[model samples]
Target: MDSAKAEGFAESLVDLINKGALAVMISIGHQTGLFDRMAELKKFTSQSLADYSGLNERYVREWLKAMAAGKIIEWSSEPAEFYFPSEHAAFLTRKHGSDNMALYTQYIQVLASVEQSILSCFYQGGGVPYSAYERFHEVMAEDSRQTILAPLLDQILPLIPDLTQKLATGIEVMDIGCGRGKSMIKLAENFPNSRFMGIDLCAEPLESAREEVRRKNLTNIQFKQADLTAFRPAGKFELITAFDAVHDQARPDLVLRTVYESLNDEGHFLMQDIDGSEHLEKNLEHPFSPLLYTISTMHCMSVSLAQGGLGLGTLWGVEMANRMLREAGFTQIRENRLPHDPMNCYFIVRK
Candidate 1:
């Protein structure tokens, strides 16, 4: 090996190792509400921050130092002050709500928890079940709360012009794989005239959705624990939505066809999933490619393979998605990318 090239590789390895450790620290900060507490205080010493957050001071100090080293927060030597700048606070704290990165960082620990199962699949050629992922529904719901529900009215729904108005005037809508029913609930609450039904294979999330509906007193929305591939509605719907949900299904192609059959003549379907390239070489250039593929291997692909499914995984690119939509009898398909969300591809399809 070239000496210089070898040195560069070593440096890159160090950087990645540091980043991995820092990611766990970031997750810890997010979970413990340390980031939020620091944002509220603006600037504080380790002891003060620990007292404010109800955490141990020594651990807090080490975490603060890590944050400073990671360039996530500002550190001062003279007065030993740690500061969360407003700019950093915006992305790091829950104050920015759905726009925060801390919410996504929580996935690091969750995915890592199943490393053993993922390894077993590598050797045994079998896959982990959905239940293998503990807290998956909860984390997924929190993720939806941040990425989808929190911005639904202002950002996501408005992507289709006049679509909101159609819902406002009363229309039948269905959401497939509607984990915890965050998007549907939001839509139902915002448009009481519209009727919404959410379906999922998992009972846990559906139960949570029903409980939330009762709490919200929403008459326009309902949740059912039904397999998407086998589900048939009494009547056709005017609109359908799937948010980061399609790739995980055991029979995603069948699910697409079912959605096509279940919609009225002019009905539209909106799907949001990982933005990826069908070509692996092209995907290698993507910023989130490593994480995406890792997620697929560890969770998305594994769960589907466990069921003897197609295992499309999280990185099913628009190229493949478009072909599938066309195959499912969707004549009009548009691929869109939002400025606010870089992680997903938005597919607007019409029958």
Candidate 2:
């Protein structure tokens, strides 16, 4: 037996197990505002922190110990005080907004909810359906608000020069798979002269989006619950966007073709998708490649397979993305990546 290889594997497995437990705890800390509260205090006892955060003292103490053991927080023995390092807080706290690492930790629990279905799919040929993921839209909404919304205005849009100005002067904009229509809402608010339409298959998110439109008195934006398969826009749009929406489609090829046809001559199609390599070997080098593949197996790929669709899965890298864009009739395709967002790659395509 190769004893050295076995020992290395054993240590790696132990580290993986530790990280799994820490992920759940971090999710708890994020959801309960414990991390946010801790960032406000310099040093605090379990009781004090629990009081400040309005959580149970006993539970808070246990959680603090776990965080300390995970090397996420500072621990002291003399007074049993815990300190949330400012440096660490930058990644942990919601104050960093979209830049927070704790944001994606919520996926650990969401993915766990469908563990049995995913396991069943492993043995069987079929896959877990979208209906099985009840909290997916909510989780996705939170994820989008944090990661996409803030940057959509200042960072993402500016990539297409004069795009914002064009919107301000009134242009047709369509966002496919616009969960809760938050992205469209943000754009509509910023560019009131532009008309916007957001389409998605899920009714729940569309309903929520309508509520937001009413609440915000947004006149330029609208949402519709429509399947992308047979989607035929009334007219060619000047701008079309799909944020983290292309990878999991039942027929992404068809959707992309439709998007190509829907754009006017010289119109722009900005698509945001996972930044990954098509090959497993290349993907192995990425830090979050494991998580990306796990998410695809559990949710993205499975849901598409459930619909009897093309399960392209995540890690459909830039090469495949560019190829697909070309096949869909986009001759001028440019890829861009944001420094702050490591998870996604932007493809700017023109008809």
Candidate 3:
């Protein structure tokens, strides 16, 4: 091969490695305050980092090379120091802001484990740790509770006139796949009189959720480390909700049946999921649609399938959801948007 071509190939190989490696590397960099340090120091040099962070110079040198190559940090040619993307400071490093970097730790850390989950596990009846399911929602809560998700849910959530009436009377609700408890927390905050329960299998995250639950001192919020199909409610809840998790379960049919049984006579099952518009062909001109579609595959669909999860929708879409509710013994079904997905429908099934 030509020298130029060979050099380009080698450079591309290194770049490919950064896709997975960057998550961990950036996580460490972020935690060590490397990003912050670079911003403050306003230059790159192993000597500077060694002195600033009090680390060995060799380690700093190696790290900075990757950071520079990754374009997460840059070497100022004139200043001969390192710096970060100025705008990233607001969202990537800021923890308290609604736009937070916590997703780095939450989502990236599990890339391997989630990717390894096999579709056969669900079909052959292999068991998944309760923890994985728990983790799914905890992470899910972060996405849905984001400023965008919340605003969307706010627009969409209020559309359920029946559920709203029940919430006004201090009714109890359960979020079956309440990842990180974002929905539970949001519900708790919005309806102070209403009580909320979250069920998931992952213990590691429930610990985190439990802490958040207590930190909020939300007397009404409760969490359980149990499988959704087996985790029985104490009694009928005024509302039983499962967000985007029904598809990830081994038996969404069974879980839906259970939700039907656990709901009060007139209680609603408020389910939120990605719009089936994923099946809709991509808009070649707009980049985001195809991006979401692929994400729906590798990260969302692939991982869920690996972990005994059904594809994103078995009974998740409007027509299928209507069918599932009827089969599960619900007498009435209403589909509406919950402000989260404009095209996605939140189905309310009356017992």
Best by lDDT: 2
lDDT of 3: 0.65
lDDT of 3 by residue, 1-351 (tens): 599999999998887677668767776676576666766666557897779887788877888888787776777767677776666655555443455553545455544454445344445634344344324555555556663344534465665675665675699888887667776776787778889899876666678778887888888888898877566778888888777667656567778889988988867787765445423543344334543454454355554444566655322345566677789898887766543244345666687
Q: Model 1 reaches what TM-score against the true structure?
A: 0.96
Model 1 Cα lDDT, one tens digit per residue, 1-351: 699999999999999999999899998998899999999999999999999999999999999999999999999999989999999889888888766888777788788888898888888887888777877888889888888877788887787889889998999999999989999998999999999999988888999999999999999998888877678888999899999889888888989999899989988899998899778998988999999988899888988888888898888788888888889989998888887778998898998
Model 3 regions lying over 4 Å from their true place: 1-18, 30-33, 36-61, 95-108, 113-156, 162-169, 276-326, 329-351
Q: Name the better of 2 and 3 by TM-score.
A: 2
Supply every candidate's count of residue pairs whose N, Cα or C atoms clash at under 3 angstroms: 0, 0, 19
**Stretches > 4 Å off in candidate 1:** none
- The lDDT per prediction is 0.89, 0.90, 0.65
Angstrom error at residue 124, model 2: 2.4
Better of 1 and 3 by TM-score: 1
Compared with the true structure, what per-residue lDDT tens digits does model 2 show for residues 1-351? 999999999999999999999999998998899999999996999999999999999999999999999999998999868999999999988888766888678888888999998999889867777667857888898899987898888999998999988998999999999988889999999899999999998888899999999999999888988889788888989999999999888888889999999999989999999999999999888989989998998888988888788888987788888999999999999889998788899899997
| Better candidate by lDDT, 1 or 2 | 2
